[model samples]
Every structure is written in structure tokens, then in C-alpha cells.
Target: MKASDQTLPLQNGETLDILFRSHPRARRLKLRYDSVRRAAVVTLPPGVSEKSGLDFARRNSDWLQEQQKAFAGQEFLSPDNFISFLGHDHLILHQPDDAGRVRREDGRIIVGGPAGGFEVRLLNWLKKQARIRLEQAVEEKTGLLGVTCHKIRIGDPGSRWGSCSSRKTLSFSWRLIMTPATVFDYVVAHEVAHLREMNHSPAFWREVDRLVDHATISRRWLRQHGPQLMALQICGKSPAD
Candidate 1:
């Protein structure tokens, strides 16, 4: 283990992975679940004691267990299985050919490539689709909000669906393309609103509301279903696999 890392046992008999990270701007001990690494992280300010961080994590053990259980059952992406895209199920079908491309046809995503390279081809196609669609959505929302962004980029961040930087650049998770259209729109509107109000203040929400009327509903949906989206692995390796 690293110097900043340790393990604790949970009441449920599961090992709780803990990391003590120092944050330059952190004001207090913050414990959060890292879904990608499947660990609970405790971020502390420079002057905070390790005992304080451990106590904080212990206090939140129940919440951590619940989150771990939720993530343990996350759905994995695999070939020949159906996945939700734009609020509809799209069957994944693999076809062997020299051409390596993915296309949607009649409720199915047809992937053409050698069997060994199918995952890489499909992931590339998904990222490309995400970039094209998200860029378009950003353009439309920014136009409606009367704000201009420096640029838009796609990413696979662990804890956020989208973010807007102080430089006016916007970055979004490519996985948003797999969710419902309204959810994607809500995320885009959220970042676009950040262009005007960088914080989650009433004024920022007002801008989001102006762009999308169902912002609250979208937020709730993401909170409830977003984890399953994040759990999808392009390697086609499910927990059972």
C-alpha cells in the first residue's frame, strides 16, 4: 500500500478501501465514494490529522456500505447484450469484416471488425458519436443562453457528468450519449449556464431553467440511474465474466 492508503473492515464483513489524500484548497474532511476505483476516499486539508480523517470515514461507514453494494451490482457493457441509448434499448451485434466501424440500424448497433478488436472499435465509435452529438447540443444551448464557450471536449471523468472551466471551456463524459436525450440536454444546459454563473447559485439555476424546464427531473434521474451508466466497461467484462 502507499503511505497515504490503508484498509478498514466494514460492519458487513467487507474490506473498506481508504485513501488519505491532501487537498490544498480543502476546508474540511470530505469522504466520498470513488466508483471507478471501487473505494472510499477521504480527502483532507494539509493540517488535518489522520485520526480525524479515519473517524470521519468510520462515521460514514453505513453510507459507504450502501454505495458499495449499489456499485457491486452495476451493469457491464458486453457484445451481444442490449444497452440503453437515447432512452431506448439497442442490441449490440458484431459482424466480422475488414472494415471496423459501428452503425445503428433498426434498433441494433452493428459493429464491423475482427472479433479480437471489437471492443476497441465499438468504444471509438461511441466516443465519436458522443463528441458529435454533445457538440451540437452545446451549440444549441449556448445559442439559447446567449453565451459563447471557448471549446467543447469529451472525457470519461469518474465523478461528474459535465463541467465548465473558468476559461469558458466545457468538458462532458462521453457516456452521456447512452442516456436519455432529455438527460443529455440537461447536462449541456447545466454547463452552458455555468458560462454565465460559475457556481450553483439561484442565478445559475435560473439559466438552466431557461434552457430546460425539467432540470430537476433530469437531475433526479441522473442521481438514481447514473451509476449504472458509469459502470459500463468497454472491455465487455461484467462481474460474472
Candidate 2:
């Protein structure tokens, strides 16, 4: 059976929706803000009571509200909005004559498609660019590290920029294409380094440093600005959510 959902009253006099869930391996109650639904989710351990979960959420209500406020300013992708593409601001242009083609010119991303499908088309184009660029970076880094990868894939995972499985397949968030080139290379290098040292030990970081210069700065940049990149709504859906 599913757990019941509840509501918590915020200090602002607004009530936020809270969903209670039971997790078998959860050691304690955990609360997280769901940016997409703009709700709170409380996870209870297998034997924990819903009352306990609600109490935990109530204790963290202030924190949850802050997170909601932080995400309130997320930008939605649209024809009228400008996006940071490859570290540059690009105006979104819709050209009917170029309906299926996606290109960049004059500091703008020109899309040829029906107005209704512009966001989707632009998203698809960004994904293509991400795959192309990330794959190239992966190939170079893997070659330098004397490692081989099985394949490269692009995704929009909520919690991570990139991941490398034991199968040697590397996966990355297509949103990386929206960040600066250095940031993009840092993520690629970080994942490729995993091929050598699967864990984030000193040796793994050493490999990443060898692959990309100013990696620490790149990491800090991501830590500060990644949310902005994730906040870019694609096809009316926020990437981080």
C-alpha cells in the first residue's frame, strides 16, 4: 500500500503539499523538495510511522520553503527567451523556411519549425550537439588515459552531470552543452577518469587534473551555475525537476 500525503503550513502562511513514501532501506526519515512538482517529499523507513515523517517534514519546513523560492525563478525555454548555449547568449529565432534545420549564426540559434514545436526542436538540436561534443571529448580523454569506452550516451539526469558504468559506457547530461567549454570538458574528463579509478580518490582526481586544466575552477563554476543550466525548461519541462 502507498503511504498517505499531507500538507505542512509554511511560515509564509502558505501550505505546501507533502507526499509521504516508505522506503525499505531508508534508515531514517528523509525530506526533499521536488522542484518539478513544487512539492515536498518525505521518505520514511520501512517501520517508521507516518506521524514521524510528518514531524520531520514540519521541522524542515523552513528549509523546504527556501528551496522552493530558489527554484521559483527558473527560466522556461521559448521562442522569446535567450539561452546560454556553449557559454554564449544566443537569441532563439524561428524561421519557417528552415523548419527542420537547427543552426547557429549571428549569435543566435536559428530553428526552422512550426512555432508550436520550436522548444522541442531546439531541445533535440541541443541534445545532438551535446552528444557530438561530449563524445569527442570522451574519445580524446579515453585515448590519453589508455582506456577504451564501449559507448557514449546523452541524458538529463537530475542529480548528476555524468556517469560511467562498469561496462565502460559513459552517460552525460545534455544540459552540459549549455555551459562553458571548460565546464563541459571538466565533466567529460571527470567521467573518463572514472574509467581508470572508478572511485573519487586522490588518484582519480589526479587523472582528471591531468585531462583538464583548471579543473577545480571548472568544478566551482558548475557548483555555482549548474542550477541555472538545469533550470532551463525544455519542452515545458525543467531539466532538474
Which digits, one per residue and each the tens of the lDDT, describe model 2 over residues 1-241?
2434578899988888888878775667778676556678888888888888888989988887776666677787677578888899998877878757899888998889677767777888888898889878888989999999998988887536898988999989898988999999999999999999987789999999899888989989986677667666865665431
Q: Give the CA lDDT, 0 to 100, for residue 96 in model 1.
A: 79
CA lDDT scores, all candidates in order? 0.82, 0.81
lDDT by residue (tens digit), candidate 1, 151-211: 9888787657999998999999888988899999999999999999987778989999999
Rate residue 98 of model 2 by lDDT: 79
Against the true structure, candidate 2 reaches a TM-score of: 0.76
* TM values, all candidates: 0.84, 0.76
Tell how far residue 65 is off in model 2, in angstroms.
5.7
Q: Give per-residue lDDT, candidate 1, residue 60.
A: 88
Q: For residue 58, what is the lDDT in candidate 2?
A: 90
In model 2, pairs of residues that clash are 98-112, 99-112, 99-113
Best by TM-score: 1
